[model samples]
Target: MWELIQSNRRKSLILFFGMGALLILIGYVFGSYYDPEAGGVVGVFFAIVLWVILSALSYFAGSKILLAVSGAKEVTKDVHPQLYNVVEEMKIAAGVPFFPKIYIIDDPAPNAFATGVKPENSAIAVTSGLLSTLNRYELQGVVAHEMSHIVNRDILLMTFAGVMLGVITIMSDIFFRGMYFGGGSRYRSRSSSKSSGQAQVIVMILAIILAILGPVLAQLFYFAISRKREYLADASAARLTRYPEGLANALEKIANSTHKLRSANKVTAPMYIVNPLKREGMKLADLTSTHPPISERIKILRALQQGVSYNDYQRVFEMIHGKKEKIIPDSVLKESIAVTPVIGLTNEDKDFNPIEARREANDAVMKLNDYNFINCKCGVKIKIPPDYNKPIVVCPRCGTRHQLR
Candidate 1:
């Protein structure tokens, strides 16, 4: 997990420098052609300020904005007791400081994700289909996987990667806009010599090329970073649960599930546990994907279930790609291996008491309600008039019609 964090931080830094350099080059070209006297300084300053302001805004409010855009609604225990219980259990096992807000989308897709700048301020959202489809153990595994993202700070890393990509795209667009709008008119005032005029035209052509290609190059970098983080998050989640079978089974189920999320789009698809966009049949050569291949992920998890270390996993991945494996520090490897799994209820275990779970659930529900209803399975609280001998009861959640006994 630490190695993943370090790798993401390094990538962010490199991209930051790369963007600054690209902006500087574009500014230099623009100044040379249009305002030779002050172009370099103006371009560099503009790039710096733009990068700083944009990055800062994304760092603080990006997660909230993303949740709102995704149409995720905040849920409480009253809304979904089962999901709240699972998330609470996972958060305890992961050693996260505060329990993240839980939410459920109305979509049928079996997908879930975690988002926030930090664990303390985080939230997790899952589809209604995920709840209805997977069994309890499988659901626990999926929730654990998302909690691993929070524990490892994957949300923050991915957010920065997106910001870098966005900045590059903006810079490229600005260059093209300037070219098209005759911002190059300043070039005529820069030089009256024939050679200088020719130089101006050459600079303009180069600027246009850079502008056209910059976004594509930036996107490639963003995708590379995203793919690597997915792998890292998988390994971290495996370590967190210590029972790779649970997550592996969940992944297989998701791949086979027919449900597709209506709210998911290209922007939010990468955030899901599985690609909620349902691109499971796409070929491996489509490397520009926001997610790694599900088959490949399943294979890795199966290997981990057989007690494969992360070092060996990295080696296998590198061999397959024909590239040198990233050498993670021993300390980080040790920490990843140290996460203990939560002890959950099992069919054979005497401790697997449904009654106790129900009691706990009921207690949690009672605490959430201000005025408790005397008779209702849905757990809603409603006041009954004194003259009413037998009042009709309605459950807001399950919608069961009944009368007070």
Candidate 2:
């Protein structure tokens, strides 16, 4: 496990530096073609400065930005006690440095994601639909999965990659727009001679090609790492919770839901437990996907007959795909010790009622909005609106007087 963390840290560094280098490369190419003198060096300097600023923002404020983009609102334990308790349990189970703040997105998509550079500065967000759809055990499974991402440093790896990908896409769009508006023709006309003009044109062509391919390559880079990490987080969740079936059941429910997430975009979609953008047919080995197939993931979890360990997951992975290839590193697998699997809640106890879940979530939201809750001895729960402004409230069912506080 330590080896995997170290490896992820190494990958994060590589991604950060690789992005900075690419920015400098693009700036130099554009500057040299535009101004033949020392402009290329100046462009490189500007790119370096921009990269530092962007990297800082990515590390410091990326999670906040993501939350804002998803329209997620932070909630206190009082606002959603059940959800809060699940996060707390998973945080302790995963042995993270701190409990991540919780956020809720009021969307109908049954999906969740984690963000931040490290465990101490992390947050886990779930769609309101997710809260309304999953049972307590299923929610625990999802929360554990997200917590394991924090434990495994997947957030840092994917966040940096996302930052780089965004930079490339922005730079590419600016370059193409400049070319579309006669910036290239103007530069060509400014050349000293026909030979110089032709040379400049060739550089421009190369720059254009680079600009076109740069974001695609970065995106592919992100997807390559992301898919593997999802699998790893799944395995880690099973081991942490000691109930692979919980997650397996959760995955099946999430996959079966047809609700589409309204706030999901390409940049934020990969961070989700399941790919919000994926349609029905994408497979685990799909190169373009940021997640393994839900079916394959569930199968691997169910196949962990011995126990939830890296060795068990790796064996199942290879068996399911019919190859002896390694998913967990040799050192990590050797170090991983399986524990006895524990029985989970029965199907009768685990049965999720979506209507009840939805009502609970709505009631929580109302409470957060300052609606007063009154409990009657007659087993009636009354919610008084803020505008009611009544000194005393009478329970319609039991005729009990309850003070509105």
List of clashing residue pairs for candidate 2: none
Candidate 1 regions with alpha-carbon error over 4 angstroms: 1-8, 27-34, 281-285, 315-324, 327-331, 334-391, 394-405
Local distance difference test values of all predictions, in order: 0.68, 0.82
Q: List model 1 lDDT by residue over 64-158, tens digit each.
A: 87677767767777656778888888887767678888866655567888898777888998776676666666677889888877877778877
Task: Give the total clashing residue pairs for model 2.
Answer: 0
Writing each residue's lDDT as its tens digit, candidate 2 over 1-405 gives 587798678778887788767877887876665665565787677666766688799899989999999988888897788999999998788765698999988887899999989788889999888888888888888999999898888998887777677777777777788778856644555667888877777878878888888878877887878888888899888888888888888888889998998999877888899888876454535877888888889999888878888888888899898978666667788788867667745573446777888987887767756787777999988888889986998999989888755
> Which 10 consecutive positions of candidate 2 have the poorest summed lDDT?
182-191
Q: How much is the lDDT of residue 385 in candidate 2?
A: 81
Segments in model 2 whose C-alpha atoms lie over 4 Å from true places: 183-201, 283-285, 323-326, 344-355
